[model samples]
Target: MLSNPSFLVAWVFKARYFPHDEILNSKKGSSPSYAWRSIHNSLDELRKGTRWRVGNGRRIHICEDKWLPTPTTYKVTSPPTDFEDFPMVASLIDPDTRWWKANTIRSLFLPFKASTILKISLSYNLPEDRLIWVGNKKGIFTVKSAYYIACNLVDTVEGACMNGLPTMLNLTTRGVNSSGFCPLCDKAIENLPHALLHCDHAKQTWSLWQDCSVNLVSLILDPIDIALNLLEKGTINDLEIFFTEFKGACTSFSLHQNPSATSWRPPPLGFFKINVDGAATEDSGNSSIGVIIHDSHDTAIAALNKVLLAPYTIEVTEALALLHGALFALEMEASYAIFESDALSLIQSINSGVVGGEIGHIL
Candidate 1:
């Protein structure tokens, strides 16, 4: 820690001016140099996450004018070979002159603090465009590896906070059966490319997929190949959009239509996504409304605290349910609302303000 002049200066001597020896080594039971060594070790050990016994208490006495400049600037006429020469030059200068000189030089290097050192180490690990240089007795080191380690640590922390299940693996293919033909569409199982691109379904999706695949070929291939193909290549962004659309199509094709799926509803727009659901039981003379409001991230922001009173008309309850969600959002400081309903006619009625019919009047 004392290797740098700034740190030494900050600790043992005051700046702008020098400090006297009496003040620098004022503690009763220890030498001034010993006290400085102890402090420096204590600081260094802290960085390494180590603890040590501190013998002397934290009090030191020094001359009153600690930060004053040295009396003689030209005292050190030449660089002397031994450490003993420092004191001779220091004595010729000011009482705390040596400490100030040490610290002033120390500032040119990075600080001894752990955070500062870690930052310096990480800067070297980045790409040349992003890398930072740290100078020491050794040549400069890049901080890329340090940055990767820091990123890994941050990712671990974020992963812990997610509190969700691992993502499901995507199935891209079905292997050939005993007959040596594709299981998905009865085509020959020749090669991976043939299996992916030559199938009947694959043929239907290829024209669009090919246009998108051009963008990502470089990242999938080598830098040399990409450089050679630059003039004829499509951009990476285009492939990304194509992949997203293709994935959505695959998911859509995977779903099986069923009687229970008839009630499935699409999502809403705006800040709050209001879902309106109504139920009625004529035998029990009961009708209830449920309204759920979600944000753009699909998190439940608010719900109608109070359910609608019983025996209400189902259509009226549905309208009230949507209104209840809106009012709840308003109370929660929502500026925009998007109301969704499976009842398309009812939604149209509300938007159109159709006043004559049964559902229209209720909406």
Candidate 2:
């Protein structure tokens, strides 16, 4: 509650010390306590999920502030005739009716953008604007959701293996399991390669699975070893088939569960469609990208979700997603794949070859 004076810490500072400013706008005072100064470190993390929940809209800036629910640029992208004219979002509202001035919005912005503004329902008795979390569907934050996000953002495979993704061998070594044998099958010691590849249950699953490229189970090499070999050999098709098969198998292996909503569509008779999307919190460096591949038959061949180490403008994130999508398609041997993204500016720039911003380098 950095912006709210109701919280104990915020109230104390507001009442006695920084009466005129909140934590977000206030500076570290002269010779501040170590604990007070340390709070600055987490302010970036806090800003990532914060967005103004429009009420009277007096507190939000029309172009500079994040009040809209839309992605990419949360603020208005359609340049105003004069930035100073509508500096505050309140200027665009019908103060007496406590509703948006619809015609004013239309004249002020592009038609599509005006529609977005119109869709925002207004309250009869307009209240003060307050910050809300956009991490979940509901505008509330929960530790359960936050923890889930943190765990998935692990940067290293070894670190991920140590976290929640453990094989029977890992459990046994940690004294969590009596023997290394998989609980599902007593066939052999269950290391990652064995449970996911050589186990009889895994073998049956792969034998019946629809792969875009290769029948990895039929190969003499271990499944994990084959993936490693493909990376070394620089062969795309076999690499694609191997991972596609494994990604499908991972659902049964109980790796990561994705909760993001997706709409499905089949590609052309001989092509695959690779749909890509990127997410970022405003002013928060935390960003992630996702790619999902579907074959002509509408079967999901493979999917990947990754958190980027460096944050970029949403445009660059989409460009990065496109880049990753192309690489993933190449790895899977989908030479006839089509890339799809929500960033219209990026796509238009790609076609024109007159790119701008950080995404230009990625393209």
Best by lDDT: 2
TM-scores of the candidates in the order shown: 0.25, 0.40
Q: Pick the candidate with the highest TM-score.
A: 2
The window of 10 residues in a row where model 2 has the poorest summed lDDT is 248-257
- The digit string of per-residue lDDT tens for model 1 on 1-363 reads 212235865654433223442222333333446545565444422222211111110121112111111111101111222333232222221233211233432332223211111111111111111111111111122255334433542453343234221211112223322454556676465333333345565555444334443443223332224334543565554433333332222221111212234453434555566776766554335456677777777687666645443344455555556655666667778777777766555677667654233222123
Q: Score candidate 1 by TM-score against the native.
A: 0.25
**RMSDs, each prediction?**
28.3, 22.7
Candidate 1 ranges beyond 4 A from true positions: 1-270, 358-362
Q: Which whole-number lDDT from 0 to 100 does residue 309 have in model 2?
A: 47
| Candidate 2 local Cα displacement, residue 52, angstroms | 0.2
Question: Compared with the true structure, what per-residue lDDT tens digits does model 2 show for residues 1-363?
Answer: 533448787776656446775455667778767876787666665566556777788888887777775532356645345746557989988987666887888887766567667756444457667676555533456666555434432323334334334677888788884788877889788777777777777777656433323455666556546667777764564455455445434432121225436665688999999999987655435568999999998899999999864444465566778877888888999989888887776777778764322223355
Report lDDT (Cα) of residue 321, candidate 1: 64
